[model samples]
Target: MKRRKRKRYVSTDIRKSENGATFLSILITFVIVMITLPLLVYLLTYVQPVKHNNELSVNQFFIFLRNDVLTSEQVYTDDDNKMYFLLPTDEVAHIEQYQNVIRRQVNGRGHEIYLRDIDSFTLQPISFGTQVTIVTKEGREYEKKIAHYE
Candidate 1:
């Protein structure tokens, strides 16, 4: 009986194949980064948050005041730029401009800011209620005539 020897087949080097795959992956990652970097930078540089100004604040203040006045039992103004509200709950709410900000106080106690960046605030007595005017530090003027029911 004769024994036959089997021939060994050598495979390709693993390192050579791995090096090509690593280089291809690196190139793909670099291309993706390069394409996205400019877009990201543009978004960061051009996209901005909505700016808030005294005009918007004043408008919001007027909206709140109108709602309060509509619900209040009585609305009146003092000698200065101050308005008072007699709530149904019998609590007094005072609205006034202190320094450069308009604030509200309940029962003459807590200090809550309503509007800011004020240059001047005026309350003119009208027939039914008062005419409110506000001048911002930026020289913008806002005026509203709020009337009370009953």
Candidate 2:
């Protein structure tokens, strides 16, 4: 009878190297940040809050104008600096920009200042709508158009 010797196995390597997933995660994060940073800076510098006499800003005024035009039955521009909207209730509402103020008259309930600190403004008739251009005292310009009879 012959006796065979068994071989013993010894473990030596213990330290683990970085996996491909770790490198992939860092690469993905870097790409996302690179794309987002430029857009964030552009929006922060381009969109700014307006200086106002009270709570209203030029942004809010445009929102109101947009709502008015969307809900109105007809829109008309008188001369150069005046525009009117005929609402669903048959109420004639008007907006006038004179001097350095923008005024809104709702359903003949008298007029109120929509915004101030304006340098100049123009209300004109376009091919399909009325266009409003407002230049504030700070040299910031805001333009909006309201489509008529929509």
What are the RMSDs of all candidates, in order? 9.6, 10.8
What does candidate 2's lDDT look like per residue over 1-150, in tens digits? 999986674655577665567877989999999999999999899887765643358878888888878888887777757778887787899988756888888875776888888888798789988788888887878888867666
Per lDDT, the best of the predicted structures is 1
TM-score of 2: 0.57
* TM-score of every prediction relative to native: 0.65, 0.57
Predicted structure 1: lDDT: 0.89
Q: Candidate 1, clashing residue pairs?
A: none
lDDT per residue as tens, model 1, 1-150:
999986675875565453355777889999999999999999899878776666678889999989989989988889987899999999999899999998999999999998888899999999888899999998889999998888
Which residue ranges in model 1 land beyond 4 Å of their true spot? Answer: 1-52
Error of 1 at 40 (Å): 16
Say what the RMSD of model 2 is: 10.8
